[model samples]
Target: MRPRKLDQPRSWPFIVGAWFLRPALVMTTKRDWIDGLNIPATGGCVLVMNHLSHVDPLTAAVFTHDHGRLPRYLAKSGLFRNRFLGIFLRAAGQIPVERASASAAGAYAAAVEAVNAGECIVIYPEGTITRDPGLWPMTGKSGAARIALETGCPVVPIGQWGAQELLAPYAKRPDLFPRKTVSIKVGDPVDLSDLADEPQDAEVLAVATGRIMDAITTIVEELRGETAPPERFDLKKARARNGRPLEDER
Candidate 1:
């Protein structure tokens, strides 16, 4: 499929990134981008997707860029540790998030600001790669919902597969030859209008997050042509089932 013409202005960081990364992606993987125009052409929005592989973000970025937007990801703070890489990331408009800490709130605030500024915020609601044995999306966190409610921006759900073929989750090496296909299906904006004016309570956020995940899972079901487990994978529950203690207690 032809890429949507890039009419939006891009900064030097984006230009440089595309110059370096896009070519490699193009050469190594075939894209099966479905309904990419579902991503807003202009305005602040949150694009939430199920996390599949470590390298999925590159595919996600290319998918977003192909449809005419630079994806500003809420990346882990650890990624910004390198002095030069940090500078490049900051220049590229990526937000550094301290995962699993009070400081993560800072990233939430930064995301809200980016959304308000009309930037496209790419968030993996699962936060990390899936642990489901079948690679179905695990239960998600509520960060994406909070940002959407705070900014009243559209929340678009994406279902992706095949990145694992290129680089399986937590795998050190990638299989680049033979060219894996990265397929992503973009769903319509999740219907959170009823909850738009509701108070930002835990229950409200969960309901919104569930809707977002459900929408994404539906699309993933479409892509995989199978049924996902009735209950999404829960890390703590899995650990308990295996007689393993939670991380903090260990």
Candidate 2:
């Protein structure tokens, strides 16, 4: 399979930050961890992460830098509409995907292409910021798994915390003062070699995605030492909406 071509360099700032700035910041409330990890400089791979706040992407970028690799990510189409930020996102090798469309197959394809091209593609499996009242990870979408199965790329489960403290969800701006510590944990690469020969099945893909997410959830609970909500993160809101009885009979 031909690898996807990433027409831009996204890891430049992260590389700069890690080499020059991360050291200074490491001293104050700073933390990061990786276990049984190996991030290949060239190859197709997916970095699946739990989302909390906007800072999630930047933190992941920093993780790639520290591990000596370039990272590409899928961003919502809305962010690319911005004049300046959009340019930066594009130059940094971010792929803009339209979620409202009937299908986001194009974006997923692009990610696969990047992997085939020997680049690391990052995806937030949750598909959006956690609405978890407690701000932990929510149930994830199956797109990440689909990409992994299609491209034969290893899915790397990532767990993150403290981005919410840097900038709480729904906050207008990030909190910069006390320099809150952020931790990123990378687990062993999830080998998808078994699925390479099998044709894609929705059920099989979902199970694969769920297994990867479960790994991430365990890490987050370990880091925070609290059990996450048992409900699948993605279905909670839809279930709530359906449960509400019809109202307002005039």
lDDT of each: 0.90, 0.73
lDDT measured at residue 12 in model 2 versus the true structure, 0 to 100? 58
User: What TM-score does structure 2 among the candidates reach?
Assistant: 0.82
Which regions of candidate 2 are displaced past 4 Å?
A: 1-29, 191-194, 235-250
Model 2 accuracy (lDDT, Cα): 0.73
- Candidate 1: give the clashing pairs: none
Clashes of 2: 8
Tens digits of lDDT, candidate 1, 57-137 = 988988898898989999888879999989988988899988667898999998999899999999999877888999998
True lDDT of residue 175, candidate 1: 97
Q: How accurate is candidate 1 locally (lDDT)?
A: 0.90
lDDT of 2 by residue, 34-77 (tens): 55245555677888889887766776675675565667888888
Top candidate when judged by TM-score against the true structure: 1
